[model samples]
Each structure stands twice: as C-alpha cells, then as structure tokens.
Target: MWPASRIPFQGRGGADFVEFSQVQDPSMSHKVQPLSSLDDLRAVLRALPGPDDTARAAVIAREPTLTKPPRSLGRLEDLALWLAGWQGRHPPTMKTPRAHVFAGNHGVALWGVSAYPPEVTVQMVKNFQNGGAAINQLCIASGVALEVTPIELERPTRPFHQDAAMDEDEVIAAFNAGFTEPLDGVDCLCPGEMGIANTTSAAALSMALYGGPAETWTGPGTGVAGHALDTKIRVVAEGVALHAGAATDSLDLLRRLGGRELAAMAGSVVAARLARVPVVLDGFICCAAAACLKAFAPDALDHCVLGHVSREPGHQALVAKLGFEPLVRMDMALGEASGSTLAVPILRAACQCHAGMATFAEAGVTDRV
Candidate 1:
C-alpha cells in the first residue's frame, strides 16, 4: 500500500479529485504477490494466468450479432474481444484507465548520447506533476488518470558501457516500485517513461535481446543526429557487448543495460497482467522495456497493444519483432505515455460499440440468407 497522501492529483474535466492514500480493493478479486528476488519474479512471469476464455467466447458470440456488417470495424472489433478476454468479463468498460510515467536519469546522458541534458528528465517530471506536459493534456482529453513517479532522480545509474547500470538489489527495488503500484480500480494501464539517454539504453537492450546491429536499433533520441547519432549508436554497441555475456537472461540484460525507468515500466506491465488488466504500451522506450518479458514467455504481451508506431527508427522494428499492429501511427516519438493515453479513447469506443450496439434481432433487421 502506498503511504498515506503520497501523491495527490486533481481530476480532469470536472471529475472528482483523488489522492494516493490507502490501496483500494481492485475490481477483480486477484491480488499481486510481493516479489523479493529475481528468481521469484521469474517464477511469477512463468506462471502468469491465462485470459478468461468464457468472456472471450461471450464477446465472439455477441460481436456477430451486432447490427454492423461482419468485420466492418476492423481492429476495433478485435480490440473489444481483447478487452473482454483480459478483463475476465463480458462488456468490458474503459472507465478509470490510468497512465503511469516512471522517470529516472542515466549516467550515459553525460556522454551526450541525447541532445537533452540529464536535468531535463527531472524537469519533465515536474512538468508532468504540474499537469503541464503533453501526456497530462492527452490524459485529460482521453479521460485517463496520470501518475508520475520519479525513481531516485539524484542517483543516476552508472554508465552501462563502463559497468552494470544497476546491481541486482537495485534492479529488484526499482522493479518492485512498479510492481506494487496500487492498481485498485484501474480498468486499463499505460506504462511509459521519462529518462535522459534512455533511448540509448533502450537501443542497447533491443540489440542485445533481438540480435541486430547497433545502427539497426539506435536512433536520434531527443533530436540528436549527425555525429551525435553516431555516438548514440556506438554507446549502444559497447553497452551490449560489455554485458551480453554476463547477463544470464532477459531480466539480467535489462539490469545490465536498462535504466531504472525501464525496469519500472517492465514491472508495471507484469503487475497489470497479474491483475488481469489490459495494457497500452507507449512509444519506443516503453516497448523496449516490455519486450524483455517476451523473451521470458512467447505470449507475455498478449494483453497489450502497441498504442502507436513511433517515428523513432527502431520502434517500428521493435513493433514488428513483438508482432503487434499498433492502434495508430502518428509519427509520434514523445514518451511520457502520450501515445498510449491518446489510444484510450479508441479502446473506449470499441467497448461502447461492443456493449451498447443493438443486436440485429432487436433492431428488426433481416439476417443474410
């Protein structure tokens, strides 16, 4: 449970304001167990509960009966079924969707891998708190609650090319910070991040896990290009080469090459899965973090949908690697859950069409002969 009054957030669009105090009972009866070690985390990932087949069957049966022509809605129809299956209930609603943005700094920022300085991460987190960031506005427009968590901003991870980004205990602690976030009444989760030079970390992790040249995974994060882009690519390659042999598995690789924000995003996805909540993965960095889970289990991301295809060069490849067709492609590369928050309304519309549409029989429409 979060400490009393840990964070207070004003509601958007005249909604009642809420505070992070005691943990509210989740809509589902499921409870997340505390993770004490990486071994425990591995076991939990392996034992992830499957979606509710009964609810899925119900969606399939009902979808055909809706007045709309068969498959006219394209991905929207699939979205409804996915929601039903993961929510473990028919007539899934997108009420109370929440977006969590985890922020951390990286020592690699000192190497100029990103155009922005490391201080920008802390500044952006403050912007998020003040409801002044792009994500804050997107969440307001989409009716999703936004929470920003800054994980030890004063202590940036050690440069990965020189040493491990985080020790095992530090990784475990960052992971738990995300794992124990109060899910309570959240119907959907959007996990995103804000970290300087994180794209370098993300690219490093992607290349290490997916096996590609550094150039294949690296991009100009924070608008770096030309010689800076070359620097970013080199950093990714060096970090991956240094840690590749020492990392026993995907999580180990994340610990070696990922920032605290990336680790937290990974943990949040797992927590959402355990609670049977669907997730909307944000841009490149967010996907890179969650992609680590897929190395553990093939269907690890079954409940998640790519919110958008980021303009970042590596994100499209990562999306292909994950086998996800994004809900939208707006050339967006902004982190902080802006893409995923924008996607919430689409899910809401899908659920509304699924649950609110009248059946052909009720509408007195003739069935096709």
Candidate 2:
C-alpha cells in the first residue's frame, strides 16, 4: 500500500491518482495499486524538475567559441551541450558520477528464458560486491562510484506469461526502493539491472510499448541457443499474448511484465530527474525502464543519455522509440551496468572538452577563413 501522503485525491494537471480498493484477484496476496493508469503515474511526471533551458542555451552559445570549427567535434560537442543544458552548468563537469546495479530474479526464468541459472543472479551480486563483475571493473577503471543493490531476488516475481509478474503494491515498493539514493553531489546517475531472464521481461515490455509481435522484440538472452532459444521466444510470445489487452498503456504494460529491478530502475530514473541529475542508461534493460518512464514523463528524456548500444535485437528499436543516439556502440550485451560504466569516461571527457578547451580568441588562434 502507498503511504497516505503519497496518495493523490484531486486531479492535478489532467491526471488522477488511482486509488485501488484491494486486490481484485483473489490469487493475489498483495494489495494492488494499478500503476498502469495515467492517474497513477502522473505524479512521477508532474514531480519532475523542468530542464534548465537557460543552461541549454548557454552551452549552445559557448560551443561556437571553442577552438574548433563549428560542429568540428560533431556529436561530442552536441553531447557536452546536452549535458550543460541538463547539468545547468555552462561547462558541465562529471565530478560526481555514480553507478547503481539493481539485482532481482524472475519467475519467467523457470521457463528457460535464459541459459544461465537463477543462482547466477545471486552469484553475480557477490561478484559485483567483490569487484569481479565486468561492471565493477569498468567502474573502477572509469573512477565512478559503484553500488550493487539486490531487490526481491529471494521472492521472484510471478510468471507473467501465466499471471501478473507482481502486484501493484510490490511494483510501488520496488520503485520506492530504487528511487531513494544519496545524490548530494552526484552529477550523473547510471542505472543498470541484473536478473536471470530479465531480457525476457525487457522484450515483453518493449513489445507491449511498441505494438509488435514477440518475435520482433524477443532475442536470445544470456546466449540461450537452439531449443532453449526457441523456448525463450515462445514463452515471450505467450507472455505478450497474455497481457495483450494492456499493450496500449505503459504503466499497465510494466505492471504485467516488468521485473522488480526494472521497476526500481524506472523509479531511480524519476528520482534522478527530480533531483535535476542526468541519467546514463545502460543497455536494453535500463533502456526499457527509461522507456517506461518516458511513456509516463516524456521530459525525463532530457535528463537521460544512452550509454551504449547493445547487440540485443530489441535495443535498437527501443532506442529509436526514445530517439536517443547512444554515446558509444560497442555491441555490448553485458548487463550489470558494464556498458554504461564504459561510457562514463567519455561523457566526463566531453564535459572536460566543453570546460577546458579555449576559444579561438582566447588561444590567440586565427579563425577558419
């Protein structure tokens, strides 16, 4: 159940808060608070801090003065400008970049949606803690702080191809759990997720959002092959069909198919937006979360950066849906924020270029004639 204070009674800006009475399904042990309705998700959208248009304009204005031909730096120049606009600094600095990995387990894993066992999720959390995971190594090399948070792994979500993955209360709880992080000095937040079969959920959510057949969004997660891959595809197709009616609604799609870590990532994205901190999304899983958030709050895109492009089949489609040009394209599919961490230094360098490069006049260099 949501806290009384968080509950909304009156409509604000044509949005209402859904006040669910109780679980409509007797099989559901937990109370349901439908996040699928716009009424339920409106607060997240409304609560976001508007982008600093002035800072955005300032970056654009400052870019021309840099010691380079106009747009010579190409996307790097644009990225720095985007960061400046959101960071609200004339020359944004990636002084405090943080990476969070949200780990969970999925009941769908039982359907052989992934080649890895469910235990890998727990084992990898330890690997993350011990700085043995790819993400940890990347963060260390990039000098970004890393935190691994395990979410409801012991209690895997219900198999959505059979039933709802989680009840509304569970969804809200996951969101709240992921939403609260210390961001006092953080300039950028990179959110990643780890869960066996999560790609299945990401695919399910993407299909739901994009209105495609499961084959269009489904892919071999964790390198499941042959029979396993075929089973994974079939299971994802079934899940999509099971919740096909909710396809048009974002929150509903999430409630039906999203993993706990996915919901938490979405919540964290919202929290980052509220704090006016920009978010760098990892690969497909994080992008799915961000996509759901964008469906609720379109402005949240202004605060997000696609860290890299994943080889996952649905990733490009999701990126296209959000219209985000990924900062790097390494064909990475490693979860646990590895892709995002790898791009952190590049983003920092972009900020450095914006801040440190001297203008042609300042450098006493002749202009391009």
Candidate 3:
C-alpha cells in the first residue's frame, strides 16, 4: 500500500486469540525492527515450486487443442496458474474450504483515523456471532466454515482482555501455539480483519516496511475524507516515525503499532504455509498482514490467493505487487473477509470446469479456432 515495501513487517491465524491495535507516531523515533539475521529470514523462504514450472506447462501442453488458444480464456488462464501452484501440479483441488476474519480494537483509533469509534469492534464481533454479519450470512449460505476471532492487542481499559490477544512477544508465542495444525486438508483459507481505524495501522506497517511517507499509502477508509483523512495520514506518519526506534523485533513493531486482528491474520498466514493450504486474500488490512507474512516466510506467498478489489488504494498496490488477479471489481470495503466468502462459489466453479470439462477426443468434438 505504501510507495514501497522491499523489507519485512509482522501481521494472524485461527483458533487461538484476539486483541486491539497498538499504534506508533512518526515524531517519536527513527529506528525500526531489523531482521535478526539474513539467514534467519532466509531460513523461512520456501523457494516456491522452483521457478521452472515445467510440469504445469506439460499439463497445458497435454490439452488436445493448440490453435483455439493463445491464453484464449484470458484471465481464466491466470487463475489456472495460481491453482497449479497450489497443487504442485496442474488440476488443483478445491475442497473443504474454510475462511477466517480476524477482528480487534485499535489503540490509535482513540486518535481518530476513523469516523466510527473503536467501540464498534465489540459490537461487530457480537454481530458475527449472531449471524447478522455479511461474512456470517454468506458463509452460512455457501456452507463454508467461517471463524471470527477478536483479540485485544492493546491493554484493555476494562478488566477482561489483558492476556487474551497478542502483544509483541505474544505474536510469536501465538504462532508457536498454532504451529501444530495440519493445513493440507484445508483447500481454501481467506484472510479478513476488523479494527476501528485499522487503515491507519495498515499504513503504519506499510511505512515501516517501505520506509516511505505515510500519505503515499493512506486512503479514505469508512467514509473518511478531506481533513479527517489528511489527519489520518499525518498521524500515521508520526506513529511510524515514533515507533520506528522502539521496535526491536517484528513482534515489537506490531505491538507498538498494529491492530489485534492484523496479528491474528498474520498467524493464519504462517499456519496456512506450514500446512500447505491456499488462502484467499481479502482487503487492504488483510493484505497488509499478508505482506508481513510474505517477509517472514517468503514461501507463504505460494499459499495465497487474492480475492477481490478493495476501494482502498492500498489494497490495489498490494494486489499488483503480490501478483494476484481480483475476482471482482465491486468497490467493496466491508472487510470481515466478506469478499473471499463471496468469491468462493466462483472459484469452485473454476476448479469444477478445469477438472470436469471433457477433452476434444473424449467428447468427439474437433478443436477449432
């Protein structure tokens, strides 16, 4: 979402915790978390199916028709490439899909990067539980198991959530906690998040990773515009600069300036890679977390799928750089993993056609231009 992002940042998972966002101020500091060692970072790179792609090329080569195509289906061929990477071969499998949306409050929302107040996070979690949320309703209609986890990343004003969601060290600890899950059976995993003023958090993480000014990535989030957005950008720039020096590890940066939902989604990304599952990408907030994961585990990039286009400019940059095709262009910014939930049936259809359509010889039809 920022002007650049060649470096790493931290961001979530299923079945463990929820929390609030910790924000940084640009006026505060100059140092940011640096990878402990290049080797430690390299240790996580998966190398991603060896770049030759000879086998996928073979699968398409085996198809009977040669002239009726030159990437004839257009974008469908693009989709084919993503699925092929997931299967480690052609004809990928799409079965037993699950989607998760992580939600949390932001400590910085108190500074007003959003029009809505931070209290909205708790209510939305309740809505998710009651089946009123878009993710809940759509998942119910589609029969995909959807999970929502709200973590209090910031120390709560109330008595309930101190240890519930992740902190700096907590992020890594949560990863270890969820590390045992077997992700092979999960064919689809989509990331979505909830946190008031989280776009500011997203921008800050982008700033840290890219070392760019905050205005470059900041955008209208939840109807904010004009002065409020400018304020959001200015505040984010300050937060990024302020927290830059305090960050000792990736976890420290996230805790000092990230939202709970982003942390949880980060865990999910790491888990999906370890288990070899493909995750559908949602919006700016989620994609920001995905970028964090990409740095932490470059191989995790192999396990991701971009779901839809977000109204947020940040998401668009992430999609372009991450190299994923959006399934729809509907100006949606609802968050909560709703885009991926809706994209499921369409993705399933793609898998169905790729596996079910008969070849020319089998159907007694000649290949034609």
Candidate 4:
C-alpha cells in the first residue's frame, strides 16, 4: 500500500499525482514556507545532506574479501559498494525499490516536434494505470512498486519556442509536488518521465547546460524524420535562443527550458538524496533532471546510478558530460521507466551477491598466489 500522506494532483481526466509523505529526517520536519521563488527552492536544496563517507569506506574495505578474484564481478562489485555507501550498510540489500513515472504534456507538441500526437501522453498514462505498459510489466516482474505521477496532464506547458514553459509559481509548485509524499521506507528510487515532445525541452535544457548547438542535442523523438526532424531541431534552437538569459543559472535554465515533469523529477532527485535513498536514472528525461539537480545540489549524483544510455541522440552526450557509465545500453527509447525497472533486478542481484557470498576463509578456499 502507498504511504498515507500521498496526495493526488488534479489533471484533465483524473488526478495524476503521488508523493512520499512523512520523510524521516528531523531537519526535514522544520517546515519552510511554501516555495515562492527559485531562491526558496535553492534554500531547500541547500539543506539536503550528502552521502555517508564512512559507510562508503566500509564497503570499499569489504570488497576485497568477497570470495572472488578481486573485481571479477566488475560493475556489480562497484554497484554493491556504491549502494552500500548511500544505504550506510556494510552489505546493502534492496529491501524496497520504487519507480516514479512523471507524465505531462509539452506545448511544443503542438509545433509538430514529434511523430506522435500529444494525446498519446494521456493514453500512455492510462496504459500505465491499467498495467498494460512495458514499465508496469517489468516492475512487477522485478518486484518493484511503481507509481505514475501525472503533473498538469490536462494543461501542457507553454510552447517553449515562443515562451517559458511555466511561470515561476507553477514551476515551484511542480518542484514542491515531488516532495509532498512520504518516502520514508523506500530504499531506492527510479525516476522516469512521459510527455510527447518533451525531448525538445530536454534537448534545449541540455544545450543550455552542456554548451552545444541545438542540433547536437536534438533527436528523432517518436520517430519523426526529414522535415519533421528539422522542425524539432529548429524549435529547440529557437527555444534556447529565447531563453538564453535563464541559461546563466541552473535553476533559471530549468525555469526557462524545462517542463513540469522535468522540474518534478528534479525535485524528486533532491528529495531522494536528502533522504539518503539511492536513485537509479532512466534515459534522457531523467538525465535532464539530474543535470539540474547537480547544479542545485552538487552531491545529489553521489546517490545516483545510471540505468542505461538511451537511444535518444542527446543522451550519449549528456551521459558523457556527467561522467556516468550506465548498466544497460539496449538503445531503448520507451520512456516509461522500462530501462530503470529492468536494472532493478540487477541491483537486487548485486545486493544478494554482496550479502550472501561467502569469503574465501569461510569457504576454506586458498587465496590465489
């Protein structure tokens, strides 16, 4: 069952909101006033705590004795240690894994930036609710609970090529929405997003943060090609140009170039890190959120795991710029937490290996010469 404090945000068809309430930290309880501005949001982010160094050291020490040729497990060994560091356990276990899929619509969708219609956003959301989505199937198979949060699904963000996606109050509200639910018992989080043409926003944000031409970050979202692809690239370039000043600061860039779903995901990343829960990142949309989170809270990535490098053209550059090595690279473009859910089983296996594998001494096996 979901925690009691979770609230639903009203959308066109129904409420599309879920949040983790009753966060465990005492510091988190000192209620700050409603976030009215970016500075207010930054202050909340500033109060977030970083990962535990002592716990990371403990995991590093234990890795040498895990009854294998040292580092033979490769990334799994690294993942085990990484998870241990944030979990503050000698051998971390995946006790509870949850996925949050944030869905919204971009006004840019009206500009023909995607091959699919904007209504697909609403339809896919229903698919997720009905357990007919790929992410739903995968989360069930992996024993991970999934929560799909629809942020302003009835109202799409402003066409970013012409104006900012949302006003400051709306942006702040969406950001705060991520922290409204209680996440006390969640061991890890996977953040994903759904919005037709959101790739344009992500690409614009990527260009703003990573300093590249819009074409460099633009991709064929939903399989648009030829002149359609050209339109996407042009729209992103124009959007970035229109918001050049907001690009000067991370929060401002997000305000100008990001959609409601992106901002909510960014807020979720901050909330997860402050709660000391490790985050497993999905593709480009998740990466775009991470980029903003890094700016506002630099240590947030310390609690993150890159689930995969997406088929989106911009994702490769963003992942490289952020210095992440993802666990999967299957060229997945399905943006409903499918990639991250697939990686949850690997994380559980890593935890199981670390906790249950016997040491050489216990196994009575001689060490290699």
The whole-model lDDT of each prediction reads 0.86, 0.77, 0.61, 0.79
Tens-digit lDDT track for model 3 on 31-115?
2222233233344444433322653675466443433345665655555556655545557666666766666666667666698
lDDT of 1: 0.86
Worst ten in a row by lDDT for model 2? 3-12
For all predicted structures, in order, the TM-scores are 0.94, 0.87, 0.75, 0.89
The window of 10 residues in a row where model 4 has the poorest summed lDDT is: 1-10
Candidate 3: what lDDT? Answer: 0.61
Candidate 1: residue pairs that collide: none
Per residue, candidate 4 scores C-alpha lDDT tens digits across 1-369 of 111123222223333332222235855452333467788777776777755788778778777776899888888888888888787667687978888888878898998999999999989887776666787667767777677778778888899889888888878877776655446677788988889988888899888887878889999978999999999999999988888765557888887888888988887777777666788999898898779878667765778988989988898889998889988888898877778878888899888988898878899988888
Misplaced by over 4 Å in model 3 are 1-58, 61-70, 88-90, 141-143, 153-167, 174-184, 245-252, 296-299
Ranking by lDDT: 1, 4, 2, 3
Predictions: Cα RMSD each: 2.6, 10.7, 10.7, 4.9
**What C-alpha lDDT, on a 0 to 100 scale, does residue 54 get in candidate 1?**
96
Q: In candidate 1, how many Å is residue 334 off? A: 0.7
Each model's backbone clash number:
0, 3, 31, 5
Give every collision pair in model 4. Answer: 19-181, 20-181, 20-182, 21-181, 21-182
Selected candidate, larger lDDT, 1 vs 3: 1
The order by descending TM-score is 1, 4, 2, 3
- The best candidate by TM-score is 1
List, residue by residue over 1-369, the lDDT tens digit for candidate 1. 211112434544434443322356567445666677789889988889889999999999999999988999998899999999999999898988988888888999999899999999878876666656787678777888877788888889999999999998888878877887777668899988999999999899999998979999999878999999998898899999999988999999989999988988999999998888999999999999999989987788888998998999899889889888888888888998989989999999999999999999999998677
Error of 1 at 366 (Å): 1.5
lDDT of 2 by residue, 145-165 (tens): 666678867889999899999
The candidate that wins on lDDT is: 1
In angstroms, the error of model 2 at 85 is 1.5
